[model samples]
Structures are given as structure tokens and as C-alpha cells.
Target chain A: MAICTGCSLLCEDIVASFENGSLKHAKNLCRKGHGHFQAAFTERTRPMIDGEQVTIDKAVERAAEILKSAKSPLLYGWSNCTEEAQSEGIALAEKLGATAEATIACTTSFCEGILMERVLSGKIETCTLDDVRNYADTSIFWGSDPSSSHPRHLSRFSYYPRGEKRQRSYEEERTCIAVDVRRSPTAQLCSNYYFRLPPGGDLPFMEAILAVLDGKIPKVADKKKMIELATVLKKTEWGAIFPGPGLIYSLQDKMELFEQLLARLNEITPFKVVPMVADCNARGFNELLFEKTGHASSVSFNGGSAAYGPEHSVLAAAKKCDAVLAIGSDPLSELPIGTARALAHQPIIAIDPRRSLTTDAAKVVIPSALIGLEAGGTAVRMDGVKIKFEPVMNSELLTDEQILARIMEAV
Target chain B: MVSAMEIYMLLPKTNCKKCGVATCMAFAVGLLGRQKKVDECTPLIEEKKYEAKLKKLREVMAPIEKASETGLIIHPEKCFGCGNCVVACPVNVAAEPTRTAVGLGPEGEKVILRVEDGVVVVNNLKECKRFGPSGTLCNACTATCPSKAIEFV
Candidate 1:
């Protein structure tokens, strides 16, 4: 069996067959996972230096030399890598991040960093995906569309299947509610239970729920539907809230309100929060970074002292740093265009198995083996479950850990 | 799924009992239930004036002709192998007692549907609820499919 690294769900029971560096046949894969499995055969990256083909050793040396000489270096993009690779990245960050102007950040700093701080600090309660499948009765998707993002979420964990306590399943026992800014595919499945919130209106929506729980009139346009939503919440045996980037960005510094809402719901019934994180091991990096440092992301180390703030974020670091090392992430296509322009101007060292915009424009590119299919390590699920995986096929390319460790030695 | 009313709209409304059914509506219903073939209606097939209606009706009911004995068609291209149908089907829930009900992939030969090669495939059509006289119009698999990949005709 193989685990798919396409998303944070980390679907474990994949039956795959590989021949001659390509996917021969696979079963139990979602559309995303199928594409991810097929990606290993397309657009394979090679070692390059300044757009010229080079040996792997030369590329590593150039990457190390560029970072060693930079006044401010930013080490970024560790979400798609394994926990072992991320640990090496952190060690490298500790070496260079201790420079007067160096910083370390990940893809989560853009959205999930602030919210992950709440989860890792015990401010919000989270559970394993297995527990959700076995016990959860009410699933509230707040600005999260698992159908388009995590395809197997509903069938494997959230709603569709019969659980230990929810043997009746979605027919009668399980109730799904979607709260989003627009009618997503998940919202359409919710039908009447979908509650549309305006952009940046998550706070008001939370207040309305609190009002209905307190038996007071809500300030929204529809009060009956609000009360009906409240009744669903009140009658929940065990509830889980799946927050996405929408809710995190909307709430921003006011994420304390979300914690208060969770606490209030727990007063009446049990509730858990699991942010719908993207990528394979984004939650893993956040948890590991949180374990080493109190803060999850956007931290800069100056003279061996770790400092945390927005000044150290990838967006801000893009302007501050003169060198970058992007592993397993494509910030050029993913970040704001302005940040991409800034990072594109700087000398970037990209380490990836696939060719992307970031790799296309990098000063140095060192290819690594694909994680789940070609190499194996542990990853954390979106719900904080640690799942260990093994490589399903053979590959001659080095893993991310070896590449990062070689660069650290060169530095 | 093509509806009875949809099939009824494409038939010849001449009310000519040449097909042995009392009314054209009953013939349309029989054609949908597979009790009467589309060629049984002589006016629609033989009469040149109603040739277009016969062609349109054939096009409409093409899915039913190719469907399994249970009148079910699962489009593999649209499926992501989430196993929603394997777990939602009542017959599968009773056959494969382990793994499928708690929301895991269904294994073994007792199951009616299994996800292979990243798509759901029919494993046992005989076990489907719509197979025999005891079969009812059970749509648990079609209704629960989020991708709308499973269809009943």
C-alpha cells in the first residue's frame, strides 16, 4: 500500500503499480491523487546553474555559496516536504537564520500560520481523522470546500460513512452545514443548510450564532434560518468545524473570536476545530516549528535569538532578503504577483522533483525524488495525525533530506 | 437518469393501439420499464411521418439499453475513487461487513462495487437491489455520489 502526498488528507490505502519510472496502474486514488501519481513521470527537473545544465554537486555548491554570502537569506517552502526534510531545513535555518538579517518561513505563513498558533497552543481543540469518522455527528464546513480540495474527506471521515455512534450516517444521524462566502460544491451538497456570509463577514456570522444560542434576536436578514442553524448546533452529539483559508484570513488577528465560539459550543456540546490545510505536510511543518519555537511561522533568528513577527513573513522577507531557497513549493505562481516579482529578482535556489515557475526562474535548481512515490517519510495529517509512509518505487535521485543536508555541509 | 415523463414526451402520441397497449402513455411507460421494446410501436418505427420521434426516443433511451440488469450506469471517468458508492449501497453494507461501513474501501468478492485503478467498477451486478423481482428502486448509490458519476436509467 502507498500513501498519496497530493493533499493533507494523506489517503493511506493506495494500491499502486509502477514500471520503469512511471505509474503503471493505481487504485483507490482521487482525481488529485491520480494526477499527483502521474506527475512523477512528467516535467522531471534536472540540476541547473544559471539556466545551464550542471552536475548535482555543482548546483549544491552554487546554492551554498549564494546563501553563505547573502546579507539576508530567506529559507522558505517546506510544506510539501516530509518531516525529516523539514527538520534538516530547520537546522539549516538555524545556521543561516542566526545571521543579522536572515529569516525562516513556510507556505503557511501566508494563511495558516496565525491560526495554527491557536491550534498548537491548546487554544483550540483538534482530533484525529479516525476519531472524526468514528464519532462525529455534526460537520460544519466554515469557508472550506473539501469536495474540491480534499476529495475523500466526506466519504472517508466527515459525513457519508457509518460511524461507531453514527451507524445511521448522513441519512439521519449526520448533519452537514456549510458556511461560505459563495455557493461552493460543498455548499450545494448542503442544500438548505448552506449559510452564505459576505466577504470579511465571518465575525458577524459568529455573533449571530452566539445570539441564537443565547435565545436573543440575531441581527442578520434571516432570523428563522439562523435559529434553525442554532437548533442543529444545539442538538449535535459531537461536532467538528473545518476552517479554511477564508475564515483564517477574514478573522486575522480576531481569531480569538473563533476560539470563543468553539468554547461556547463546547459548553452546550462537544466541538473540535481542524483547519482545512492544503498540501501534503503543511500541518507537519507547523507542528514541528511550533515544537522547536513557541511560534509556528514567520520567525527570524538574529545572533542565535529567534524573533517572531510580520517582518519575517515570506511576503516581507521577499523584500528584505537577497537570497532564497525554495523546496517543494512554488511561491511565484502561488504568492501575490508583487511578492513573486520581488523574489524573482533575487537569486533563488529551488529544490523540487517537478519543474514549476519557481524552478524555471531560479539561479540554481537541484532536483530531488518525489515524496510518497519515489521516497518515503512521515507526514502529519490536517487533523494532527502522524502517518508514516514508505516509497512505492525505486529512484536514483536523492531525497529532500539528502539535498538539504548536502547544502548545509557546503555552507 | 432519463425520467418516465421525459421518455413519454419523445413517444408518438397518436393513441394508436397497434402496439397492443391501450394508450400511447402506457406504451411509453412499458418502453421505460423494458416490458415493451421501442420497435413494438409500429406507427413510430414503420410510419415515415414519425421517424424523427423514433430516432429521438432511441437516443434518449440509449443509456437504459447499455445499463446493467439493475438499470444502473456508473461513469468511471467522473469518479475519483472516493468509495462513496461502495459504502452507501445497502447491499454492500450488508455484504462487506468490515472496512466499507466505517468509510473505508470495500474489499473481497461479496461487494457490488470496488474502486480499482482509481475508479469505481461493478464487482457483482447480481447483488444489486434492482436486479430481480425483489428489487426495489433503491438509489442509495446514485443519491450519495457527490460527483454525479453514478446514474440510474
Candidate 2:
């Protein structure tokens, strides 16, 4: 059995046969994951210094030298690696008096932290994906498009398949709804049930839904549709709302409305909110930060002082720092180009398995082993389930943990 | 070489001085010979005229947008049909099928990168506004490739 690390789903059911030193027969891998697995054979980065291939020891020494010589350094990108690696990376950040962050920019500020904190503190109802598949009768994709992001979502859990309780399944048991700006794949799957909102219109939509849930007519463009959707929600046996980046980005400072909506829904029926994270271990990082720091992001342990706030986030800290150690992520390709350009100009150390825009321009490049394939560790699924796995393939390259450990030692 | 209407269309869109340029119209003039992304019009895209004027705006902003050939191909067989790819895709390329999967592979896992005669080809790659393909090789999915079968060429 193969494990796909393409996204956070970490789908464990895959069949593949090796032929001619390459994967030939494969089943259950998405296009993005296919590209990821194939990356092992193409554009593999080497320990490099100033664009020339160097020994691992030399590259590590150079990275340490850069960090040691700098007054302020930023260590980023832990969402792709394991908890063990993340811990080691954090220790290194502390030892070097540097600021550390995850792949996505101050993601917690975006709302996963708020949700996780509530979940951990018992402010909301939640369930595993397995539970949703088996028992959930109503699925709501709020500002989320699982189609392109978590491709196997509907079939594996939320909307498809006949589970223990959901005997009728897609035909009679399940009802799916999508709320997003675009007519997303998930929305298309939901067909007529799809509801489109203008960008940044989530709050109004939520208010409208809340109004309908209360039997009051919503003051919005489509009052009738809102009423119908609210009716569906009011009558749901088991409901779940999957919130994505769109909702978070739109309701940056105004997530209390979401909390209110969830509270209102639970009054009528069982409801759960599942955050749609982009990476495999975002939840893991969220869990760790929630446990260790009482916050989900923008945490710093510098000079024996731990400061956490939005001001300490990567987006803000990157400008104040002199050096950056980015691993397992390509913020250059992911963030606004301006942020990417700023980080790119700084003395940078990039650790990744494959070539990326960040690695290409980085001053120090350390190639780490692929997780779940080249390395083994534990990760937290989106629903908060901890999954442990062993490497399916052998590799001599150092895992992110080993690399971070070495950097910590050198620093 | 420009008309009054074209000049009106090029009026500055935002008062935000993040661009250092005073008015959006000044920024538009600066963008005349330079590369400017649609997102730069942070305020403009939100206007009612956006969709209506997109054709003309795109024409005038031709120098700003880059062209690429590669697009995403969905194989219905391997796709779990969770629509993660559809959402995570910066481009609005991966979409839900108008029809249901009658019987292919597993119920959800059978979704494939839509392919063509022996070669996996993606349609409307040109129209995709994302920095990469709608099905861009983000490798987010590969990070979870359990079978290790998902490959990139």
C-alpha cells in the first residue's frame, strides 16, 4: 500500500508497481500527487553552495555560518514535514534566537487557530471524516472547494459512499451544498444546490443563513434561495460544514459570525466544522502550537522571551529579519510576489526534495527526504486524527528532522 | 494612438498608495508599457464594469499577461472526486463532471486527470488566470500519494 502525500488527505489506499526504475502501474493517485511522486526522478536538488553542488557537510556548515553570523533569522516551513522535524526545527529556531513559522503566512490569523482553539477548548462540535461519511446526512462546503483541493473527499467521506448509517448514500441519504465565489468542482457536483456569493460576501451570506435559520427573511440578493438552504440546514440529521481559505481570508477579523452560525446550527441538529488546510500537517502544526503555545501562529521564542502575535508573523517578521531558513515550502511561488521577492533578496537557506523557485534562488539548498516515502513520522489529519507511518521507499538522504537537528547542532 | 474611451478605461482605480504612485490613473499610465497583473487593479476587478470590460482590458494589458501551453489533465479513474483539486487549484480548471461516474475504478478514487489520445491534455489552458495551470503541479496531492503512483513529467 502506498501513501499519497499530495495533500492532507494522506490517502493510504494506493497500488503501484515499480518497472524500469519508475512507477508504471498506479491506482488512486491524483494529478498533483502524481507530479509529487514523479518529482523523485526529476529536478532533484543537491547540496549546493553559490549554484555549485557541494558536500552535505559543507552546505550544512554554510547554512550554520549564515545563521550564526546573522542577528535576526526567520525559520519557516514546517507544515510539510513531520511533528518530530517540526520540533527539531523549533529547537533550532530557539537556539539561534530566530523567529520560526509555518509554510502558509500567519495562517492562524486566517482562522484555523480560532477554530482549533475552540475545538480544543470545547467551544464547538466536531467529528472525524470517517464519522462524517458514516453518519453525516448533510454536507456544507462553506467558502471551500474540496474538488480541486482534497479530490477524494466526497467519495471517501463527506458526500459519497454508503456507510454504516448512510445505507442509501448519494441517492437518498446524502445532501451536499457548496458556498463559494466560483462555481467550484464541489459546487458543480452539488449542481442546483450550489450557491454563489461575491468575493468577500461570506459575512452577509452567513447573516442571511442565520436569519433564515431563525425563520426571519434574510436581507440579501437571493432571499428565497437562502430560505430554501436554511430549511435544508434546519432539517439535517447530521450536518458538517467544511470551511476553506476563502472564508478565512474574507472574514479576517470577523470570525465571530462563523462561530455564531455554528452555535445556531447545533441548536437544531448535530453540526461539525472541518477546516480545509492546504498541507498534510497543517493540522498537526495547529495542534502542536495550540498545545505548546496556546496559539496557532506567530509564535517566537527569541532571547528567552516568547512573544506571539500577528506582528510576529512571517509576513511582518520577514521584513525585520536579516536571514531566512525556508524548508519544505515555496513561499516564492505561493505568496504574493512582493513578499516572495523580499524573502528571496535576503540571505536564504532552502531545504526541499525537489527544485522550486525558492530553492533556485536560495543561498543554501539542503535536499531532504520525502515524508511517508523517504522518511517516517507522525502527522495530524485534517480532522485531528494522528496518523503514524513508515517510509515506503528507501532513501539515503536526510529527513527534515535529521537536517533540522544537524542545523541546530551547527548553530 | 489612444482614444478618449480608452483613456477613461485606464483611469486610476485605487487611492491606496501602496503602489507609491498617487492615483490609479497614473498607475495605469505607468502600466502602459510595463507588466501589470489584473490583481493590481485591486479595486477595479470589483467594479460592475469588470466582466463587461474584461475583454478590452485584457487586450490593452496584453504585455502584462504571460502565455504558457501546459494545462492539467484529469484522470477520472484515480480521482477521489473530493474536489480538493478543484478548490486548491488557483485556476478554476478542475471542475465537477456534469454527469456522474457510472462505474469506473472506485466511486471516488476513480477521478482521473482528463486525458486525450495517448497523451494527457488539458483544455482551455490559455484562459486560466492562475499563475500556473488550473491543475498546476502544486504537488500538494503528491504529498499524500499513498500508492506513489502519481507522477510528474
Candidate 3:
């Protein structure tokens, strides 16, 4: 079986057939994952410096040289790489006395890292998506639209599948509710269960739900709708809330209210909270950072000491650092225009398998092998499930682990 | 696609310089092209039929046409007394409020930060290192802005 690192699902059920060193067929791959797997054969980047192709060794050498000569270097983008590679990256950061951050800093600053860190440390109750598939009777998509992001979310895990306990399947056992600002694809699928709220209205909506749970009137223009939704929550046997970027971005400082609601819901019945991270290893990145230096996302190793705080985040550290080594992420396309331009002007080292806006302008580009397919290691699924895998194909390209290791060796 | 001449014939054609353009016809053309919004035409919506046409035209140009990969939408109604997006925008694409409008969502609702044009301007001007750049419409700055102003459309 092959693992698909296309998204945070980290689906371990992929089946691929290679013939004459080319892909023959692939099964159980979603359109997005299929694009990811197929990406191995197209738009592959070569080792380059100053927009000129160079040998892999030269690229690695140049990357090391840049980092070694830098005063404050920022090492970012490990969410798409393997755990082994991430370990090497941490070692490199420590050796170079640089700040080690991940794609989470950019995403979680507005999303769920703070909430997830607490949840992971046992501040709240949660479960794997597998548990949701088999056990959950109610699934609430708050500010998450998995229909567009994770196309196979419903059919493979949440709504459609008939798991060990859900013999009756989605026909009678499961209910999917969507709470979003707009009428999204998932909201349309949810039909009557959809709760459409205005922008930045998540806090008030949560309060209304809390009121309904408290057996009091909800403070909203549509109190009857709130009452009906509250009734659904009160009767849920097993429920799960999937918080996405929309909810996280809107309620930046109000995550405590969400935690309180979860606490309140637990009193009525069993409930769990699951965060929707963008990358496959967002959870893995958090867990690895936590286990290494007792930090979840941001950590600065300047002067050979690990100092961690929100200010050490990539968004916070990008401008402060003199040079940045972006691995497996395209910050130029993923950050705000100002932040993108700020980091772009620095001595940027982009390590990616394909061409991106960052690679186009990078001072050094060291192309690495794609994880989960060309390379093999472990990655944490979105729900904190640790999954291991082996490489499904062979190529001359070095894995991110090998490259980072080489850089560490050079340094 | 209403002609600029018909647009001029229908409304007061205030020829007000407030819309930036010299004539309401130019403003109408700008509005149709998303270069300008009907709300910019202070007098265009004063007449009942012109207002009805503006409302209908705004509906025809609902939110999806303006959606970028990041799924951010600008709320015109919610966006007032706040110029945070202008400062929060890294590429400075949204620096000019007059050119901004609701990207993808309801009519007369949700103002996009003009990141599309900003991306173009940044590239054209070759303004490097002003803010962090990403492959997608990154809301990192907006995410960190003290004002909770940026929203996904």
C-alpha cells in the first residue's frame, strides 16, 4: 500500500502500479491526491542558483554556505516533508543557531494551533477521524468547508461510510451540519442542517448555542432557528466539531469560548473537537516541535539556546531574519503580499520538487524528492494519527531528509 | 453589457468628478469591467430605474467572479471606519479604496482587498520584500493585523 501525502488525511490506502519506470495506474486517489502523485512526473525543479541549473551537490553546498554566513537565518516549511527529514531540519537549525518554524506559523496564527496545542496536551477531549467514522452521530463543520479542500472527506470518513458501529450508514445514523459565512458546497450538501452566519459572527453564534444548551433563549434575530439547532445538539449521542480556518481566523482571541462550549457539551453527552489543519503534517510538525524543545510552533535557537514564543513564529521572524531557507513551501504564494515581498528580498533558499514563485526568485534552489512516494517516512495525520510508510518508487533525487542531512554535514 | 451611452442616457449623468472619471459613461464602463463599483457613482443610483439597473447589474456580478484561490471575500457593509486592510495588505494592492469592491459574495457586500491587482502591481513594479509573499493569496498579515478585519469570502 502507498500513502498519499496530498493532504492531512495521509491516506494509507493508495494503490499504484509502475511500469517501465512510469505510472500505470493508481487507485483510491482523490483528484487532489492524484494531482499530487502525478506531479512527480511534471514541472520538476532542478538544482539552481542565480536562475542557472547546478548539480545537486553544488546546490546543497551553496545552501549551506548561505546559512553558514548568515547572522539570523529562518528555517521554515516542514509540514510536507517527512518526520525523519524534520528531525534533520531541527538538527540543522540547532547547529546553525537559527530559528526553526513551520508552515503552521503562517496558517495557525489565524487558525487553530493554540487550540490544538492545548487539545494535544489533554486540555480537551478529541478523537481520530476513524473514531468519528465509526462512532460519531453528529459532525459539525464550523468554518470548515472540506468539500472543496478535502474532496474525499465525506465519502471516505465522515458522512457516507458504513463503519463497524454505523451499520445503518448515513441514511439514518449520521447528521452533517455546516456553519459557515457563505453557502458553500458542503453547506449545500447539508441542506436544512446548514447554519449560515454573517462574517465575524462566530462568537455570537457560539453564545447563542451556549444559551440554547443552557435552556435559555438565544440572542439572535433568528432565535427559533437557534432553538432547533440547539435541540439537535442536545440529542446527539456522539458529536464532533471540526474547526477550520474561517472559525480560527474570525475568532482569533476567542478560542476560549469554543473550549467552554465543548466543556458544556460534554456535560450533556460525549463530544470531541478536531481541528482541520491545511497540510498533512501540521499535527506532526506541532508534535515534533513540542517533543523536541517543549514548543508547538515557534522556536528560536539563537546563541545555541531554544527560546520559544509566538514572536518566534515565521510571520514574526521572517523580517527579523537575514536569510530564510524555505523547504517544501512557497511563501511567496502563501503569505500576504507585504510579507511575501519582505521575505523575497532576503537570501532565500527554496527546497521544493516543483517550480513555484519562491523558487523562481530563490538564491539557491535544491530540488528534493517528493515525500510519501519518492521517499518514505512517517507523518501525523490531521487527527494526530501516526502513520508510517515506505517509498513506492525509485529515483536519483535525494529525499528532504538526505538533503537536510547533507546540509547539516556540510555545516 | 449595457452601452456607456445608454448608461449616460438613463441616469442624471451628473458628470461629477467624484467618480474620478470625467463622465458617468466612463464610470459605467468602469463599473461593468469591475474596475469601479456602482456605489462610486453617487448620483447613478438616485433615479429609481437607474438604481434598479444598478442593483440588477450588481447581482449579475456576484461574488464568485472575484474569488481567488484563498477564498477571501470583502464585505462592503462591514468595511467602514477601518482601513486596516490597506495597511495590512503586504503588496499594497488595496491601498486605494476607490478601486476596491465586493469580489465574490452578495451584491453590495464583501470587499476584496484587491490582491489580484496588487499581485500584478507588485510584479510590475518589482517591489520585492515589502511584505511576505506566497503562492496563494496569503492572509498572514491580515491574520496578524490588530484589527480583525480580513475575512475569507
Candidate 4:
């Protein structure tokens, strides 16, 4: 059995079989995981420098030279890499006196927020997926569609399985609610319980919930529904709210409202919040960086200490830095087109296992072995659960950790 | 699933507004959503000429067994093709020749559930392990379905 690093779920029960030099079949893989596994056989990257094929040694040397000589360099894209590789990446950033940021930094300014601070300080309540399965009676998908994102979320933990306590499961016991702007797939599953708010209406929605909890009439168009929802919350024995990008992006600077809501709900019953981080190890990177430094998302070590701000973010660093060393992530395809264009102007050293838009545009590309399938490593799941796995197959390619160590050695 | 045309055929083509709807076609559309019942039409129910049509309409529009006594019953309309069942099923996962094969093609067929267009399709029902005489009742796919599309009967 092998783990699939396709998304943040990091599904660990994958049964993969290989024939000759290609992937033969894989079971227990979502569509995203299936695509990720198929990526190994199709459009595999080769060692290249200046659009010319070269040896892995030559590519690393070029990448090292670029990082060593460049002034105001930036190390980006650590969310997809292992915790070990991320640590090495942080060391490389410190060595070059450069700024380092991941894709998570672009979503919300989690660094300065009370949310990240509370998570780091362990002030806010959090529970694992197992806890959700066992104890939770109310599972709220606030702006997060686990059906499309974490496919097995309902089956494995949230809504479906018959836990020790939740023997009746979703039919008689569990209540699944979706608070989203549009009727997403998960919202559709919520059936009559879906709360449809307008875009950027999360603040008012939260205020309405708080109002209903306070026994005041909400000023929304649907006052009765809000009261019903509040009634459900008030009666919940154990509830968990999974906030996705929609909620985070909608509640940007007003995250205090979410905290207030959580606090208010806790007054009635036990409630926990688990952020719906996207990438497999985004939370891992955040936790690792927070452990090393005080900040959670973006930081710079140029002035002999860790400095973090919006200016040090990937978007800001993209314009200021002369060169960028992106690993395990394809920012060109993932980031906004303008940001991608700005980063495209600079000399990029892309270290990845597969060919992507970032790898296509990089001045230096060093191919590495695919994690989980071809290289053994440790990764943190979205819930901060540490999962260790061994390689499912043997590969001649070097792992990201080995490649980053080589680059550090060359520099 | 009964088609709108099938329901439309049973409706009296009077284009009457007595049912509050503008046309028989509109009434048939409402019947699909359970919004308008076949007996809602005053002329159809009261008039002896439309008795046969009304009887057939009621039979066709009647709710079927969404959940069975055993096995799985998938409501394709509710399935958003998330492929949760495809991955969560132990039977699909334990199948041989594990490589990455996507789409509805026959080669490298690993998963029993396939998402076509935007709905979940049971591609290989024969490969389902629950069908054998062992009476092994595995609803892993049905249990994990977030959309509640899969019903274990």
C-alpha cells in the first residue's frame, strides 16, 4: 500500500501495481489522484538548463550558481514538498538571505491573524478527522466542498461511517450543513439545509447566526431558516466546522467574526474548527515554519532574523526578487496570470518531478522522484496528522530532499 | 427515471390554465419536481374523458423504491461525479493490474465507479464483489458518498 499525495487528504491506502516501466493500475485513488499518478508516465520532465537538455549534476550546478550570485533572491513553493525538504528549503533561504513563501501565503494573511496565532498557541479548539467520526453529530462544511476536494471526507470520517458513538450515522444522528455562496456539490448533498449567501456575504451570515444564537431576530431575508440553523447548532452535542478558501477569502480581515461565532457556539456545545488547507503538506509547511520562526506563512531572514509581512509574500517577492527557486509547486499555473507573468520575467530554477507551466518556463529544471510512489518520506496531512510512507517502486531519479541537499552543497 | 416527454404524453393537451400552470408541458415539468400531482388538474381528474390518461399518469409519476432491501441504489441525478465511491470501494482498490487508467476506456480499468460528464456511472457491475454468494455486504462506496446519492438497500 502506498500513500497518494494528490491533495491535502494524503489518502494512505492506495494499492498500486506497475508493469514494465509504466503504471499498470491503482485502486483507492480519486480522480485527482488518478491524474497525479498518470502524470508520472506522461510529460515527465528531463534535466534541462536554458531550454537545453543537460545532466542532473549540470542542472543543479546551474541552479546553485543562480541562487548564489543573485541579489534579493526568493525561495518559493514548499507546500507540496515533504517537511524535511521544506526545512532544507528554509535553510537555503537563510543561507542566501532571501525571502521564502508558499502558495498558502497568497490566500489569506494567516501570518498576522489571530487564527494562525491561536493555532500555533493552541488556544482554539481542534480535533482530528477520527474525532469527527467518533464524536461529532454536526459536521458543517462552511464554504468547503469536501466532495470535490477531500473526496473520502464523508465516508472516512465526517458524515457516513458508523462510529463508536455515532452508530446511527448520517441517517438518524449526524447533520451535515453547507454554508456556501453557491450550491456546490457538497451543498447539493446538504439538500434542504444549504445556506446560500451572496459572494462576500459571509460576514452578514456570521452576524445573522450570532443574532439567532443571541435570541434576536436576524436582519436577513431568511430569518426562519437562520433560526432553524441556530436551533440545530444549539442542540448539537459535538460540532466541527471545516472552513475552506471561500470562507477565508470572504472573511479576509474580519476573521474575528469567525472566532466570535466559534466562541459563541462553544457557549452552547462543544465546537472545533479545522482549516481546509489545499495542498498535501501546506499545514506541514506552516507548522514547520512556525516552529522554526514565529510566523506561519511567509517570512524573510535577510536582517539576521526572521521577518514576515505582506511584502515578503510570494506575490510581492515575485516583483522584487531577481531570481526564484520554486520546488514541488507550479506557481505559473496556480497563481494569478499577472503574478505568473511577473515571475516569468525572472530567472527561475524549478525542481519538480513532472513537467508543468512553471517547469516549462524555468531557466533551469531539475527533475526529482515522485514522493510516496518513488521516494519514501514523511508528510503532514491537513489535520496535522503525521503520515510516514515507503516508496512503492524503485527509481533512478533523486528525491526532492536529495536534490535540495545537492543544491545546498553546490551553493 | 421517467422523462418529461413521457409525462407530457399522459397529460391532456388542452393547454388549460385550470391547474394554475400555463400549459400541459408546464404541468408535466412541475410533476417531475413533485410540485404538481397528476390529480392537481381539475379537468383531468373531474372529466370522465381523461380517466385513462390520469390513471397512467399516476402510475408513471409514482415514487419508486429509492432504497432497496439489500445492495446499493444510486440516484444518478444527485451524483456530482466526485468519484468518492470509485476510490473508497475496497473492491475497486483490491482489483488487479494497478496502474493509472482514466476515462471510460476499457484499458487499465481499475475502478468500478466512473464519472462521465458530471454523473457517477457504475462501469463494471460484474466486478462488484458484493454480488457473490458469500453475502458479503460491503457498502464502502455507498457509505462514503458525500452527496447521499448512493443508498444502501
> Best DockQ goes to which candidate?
1
lDDT-better candidate, 1 vs 3: 1
lDDT digits (tens) for residues A98-165 of candidate 4: 33322223222332233545666676788887788779999999889888887767656777555668
Task: Give the CAPRI class of candidate 3.
Answer: incorrect
lDDT of 2 at A285: 74
Task: State which docking tier applies to candidate 4.
Answer: incorrect
Chain B: TM-scores of all predictions: 0.85, 0.31, 0.33, 0.47
Cα TM-score of candidate 1: 0.96
* Candidate order, TM-score descending: 1, 4, 2, 3
The most accurate candidate by TM-score is 1
Write out the backbone clash pairs for model 1: none
TM-score, per-candidate, Cα-based: 0.96, 0.73, 0.71, 0.78
lDDT of 3 by residue, A1-411 (tens): 788898888866566777775567764465567667777787789999998999999999999988888877888777788888888887788888743322223244335677677777888788988888778889999899886676556655676555667655455787889999988767766777889889899999999999988889998998888888888898899898888888878656777888898899999999998888878777887788778776666678876578766677777778777888988678888888888888989999999989899999899999888888888889988899999988898877899999999998987
Best by lDDT: 1
Q: Candidate 2 - CAPRI tier?
A: incorrect
Higher-scoring candidate on DockQ, 3 or 4: 4
What DockQ does model 4 achieve?
A: 0.10
Better of 2 and 4 by TM-score: 4
